[model samples]
Target chain A: MATGRIVIDVERCKGCELCLEACPQDVISLADTFNAKGYRPALLADPNHACTGCALCAVVCPDACITVFRDVPTPKAQVALEV
Target chain B: MATLTADITEKLVYQRPDALADLYTHYCPGCTHGTAHRLVAEVLSELGMQEDAVLVASVGCSVFSYKYFDVDAAEAAHGRACAMATGVKRVNPDKIVFTYQGDGDLASIGLAETMHAAIRGENITVIFLNNAIYGMTGGQMAPTTLPGQHTTSSPFGRDIKLTGNPIHIAEILGSIPGTAYSVRRSMHDARHVIQAKKAIQTAFEAQQKGLGFSVVELLSSCPTNWKMTPNEALSWVRDNMVPTYPLGDYKVHEELQSKRGRGR
Candidate 1:
């Protein structure tokens, strides 16, 4: 299976939480810490690589603070899993 | 999918549009102005019109649009964006010229300028942000304010009888024979945002091909002036605003579509 994640540019975020609402995977939330702009930036809650990289956050992000990346499952890893 | 992810740089699915500057804008958090600006910048970059575009910024909240978009910009007086855009378009016929205006500037003070330019069929594009309030001036009642909607000036809610009905600018402009394209789009959700971007792209193309005047009226939200949280404002636009300002294409010329090579 492919693993995916979202990267946020904290300094650019205004903590509007529009991305939090838009996230379908329920992986994003506002951090307790504030950015240079004095707004709490959005952070991904998933640490176990549960992201699907749907890019919904990027789509609704007004500040363009998010970028999505995915990890492709390798054939060797699949063979190891089968073993 | 697994084979593609091997390249790290290939993971770049989305980023800021190159047409946009890196500097920050002062718009309120969660205000749709930022989204609207991004849409225009993305479309301009997609069409490779960054250097050729001359943006005309009008008064009101959208006045800073010039600073946000990485292109030649000229600031227009109150409600005079279209008039200035007309001269800019006329002088530089080869350049793509468009005006970014808010409801207070477009439907109120500069109504005449917008109408006359549309009537004259000037080869220009207009991105009209209809937030239905005076955003920069403390949320006063605008010409597009909904019936019974309250504002700073209309503390008791807007009475259509007293202030007249909210102007349907898109429909009015669509009715003009000279208008090559006129459409209304919302910014409440991802679907509408995509549609809005497409509409903006088409509007710019209409001007690029020397088609008649074009206008893309975006139903955006002003969270700060509305006195609602950003999330609440987005919902308000989905509920209250969408009902009053239904989204659709009012007019699309055949010549313009043929150029884009699509029936829509």
Candidate 2:
């Protein structure tokens, strides 16, 4: 089954560590090296396969650097129109 | 299945609030703090600024405002909400910053910080809740308390000879050059609540546009402190407080322009 994904904007990330602590699925990890701003940005170790898209990480991020996209069921209209 | 009606409660709910330690609020029943909290939360949710917005919670009853608000909040010392908010906004210019303060915090102890922040035209919003009496610290007389009002400190009713007159904070703030928007409204009833919401939303929008300081003074009720029932407190606010405060726009940039003959 497909799942939603979490994307982090590394440049804007302030390395607040809020998302690192908030992600219940334990799929997010900090980068080994710091960015230009000298803060280690958050990254997804594994994609949505392990992410639940609960949006806890996005809510806790103080920099507003996280975005979540969830997979949706295909609309019936699309199937009917294709047929 | 029946179609569900989109209730006002649903629209006002905070969908994306931050998760900090959740402690039970210590507000009286029918207290306007809950409504005020919801208004701010709703605005943050609408603007998608909840993640970046940092609220400065003042002392007095609202000292624990950070608990109720679902955003990044920091507790400031008594009457220093404006200064704390100033530091936070200055350090992080991209974040939407605001201060939640009471009459005592803004008008009495923190008066200097509040005035200077307005004079400097800091790009922030100050949600000033004026309930006449201090709520958190056992109902003490505040700077904005009504004349002849009876409070813990003014047990025998505020004496004009001793307590002096009530301070008109909104009118005073409106006169400042740095203030971009200043509106005094109330939340006594549904009608006033609507107006209060509009004023609050406008202040938030002004911040979003990077405009200078904006303040919305809400005439709230304190039934527990006022020594009256909830309904009576609302009535007192409508009959007495509104007259002294006088609900209306005190200053507008367009008026300033015309007065300066810029339009002519």
Candidate 3:
């Protein structure tokens, strides 16, 4: 039940497509616009926001271009928020 | 769909390892050399051995490997990485010395140095990248090239009858009594990549304990040389390479076995 997202460093990504295949949720895709390096970089194209931030994409990323982030619960003044 | 939750804060789960340089590599797309380097950097960072580590960069596609790592490094002549590493480890004794080599550099030209180092029981780690072709030299055949596999030199496909079979480096090294640990792992998928990382960690640990020579032979990918897309090259490794070079620990020292528990 964890919500996660990933940021791809466009400049470093070579568009190898390993991340695309590695993503279990099929959330990543190649961008149409090419980066400065002329390579179409992978982007988080998750419409349903199904990413769980498993870091699998980053794990299989040969370029080490994907940075993964996950949402954490912050306990403070109790405000029951529905997500 | 609604869920009860507190204030949501984002935490970075994964990023580039500290030991790796913040610079672009010259490796071709989908080349697993970068993956192997990343794994080594992560291991060095995790073990807090960055400052005390010395990298011996070998010739080949990863010849500029030292520039990618933030550690004391030296460039060895072609196929002389293990021999150079022997000197470095002997001189420093306390430093963690390791070599990063390719198929041509290790299995072909450097075989003697590699075998002698292992036989001498040198306390050093070797990260051997075997992609089955001479990547830097325009994808020519290498000592580890698979049978019936086509390279520039083997345009008609490799003939095991004429050229002999692929040299199983890990198996040969594992049989050497001086080697503390020897294993072969692949980088074709996420699961296998993680397993490769673990094997690399174990190899380094073997060196850390002064056990002896440790080498982790990574069955990596070379998309450009293999004349296939990145994804296809990964599959090629799984379908073609894995069968030729089975993945497993060929040798694990008794002490390391005890430390890691039974069953790899």
Q: Tell me, by lDDT, which candidate is best.
A: 3
Superposition error at A30 for model 3 (Å): 0.7
lDDT, residue B86, candidate 1: 92
Q: Estimate, for each residue in B14-44, the C-alpha lDDT of model 1 and write its tens digit.
A: 7789998987888888988889888999999
Q: For candidate 1, lDDT tens digit of each residue in A2-56?
A: 5578889899899998888888778899999999989999999997667778777
Worst 10 residues of 1 chain B by lDDT: B255-264
Clashing residue pairs for model 3 = none
Candidates' lDDT values, in order? Answer: 0.87, 0.74, 0.92
Higher-DockQ candidate of 1 and 3: 3
Ranking by TM-score: 3, 1, 2
> Each model's TM-score?
0.92, 0.68, 0.95
Which candidate wins on DockQ? 3
Write down the RMSD of all candidates, one decimal each. 3.1, 14.4, 2.2
Worst 10 residues of 3 chain B by lDDT: B255-264
True contacts kept of each: 0.43, 0.00, 0.84
Query: Which parts of model 1 are misplaced by more than 4 Å?
Result: A72-83, B1-10, B257-264
* 1 or 2, greater by DockQ: 1
Q: Which stretches of candidate 3 lie above 4 Å from their native place?
A: A75-83, B1-6, B258-264
Cα lDDT tens digits for candidate 2, B180-231: 7787887666556657766777787777777788898888888789877555
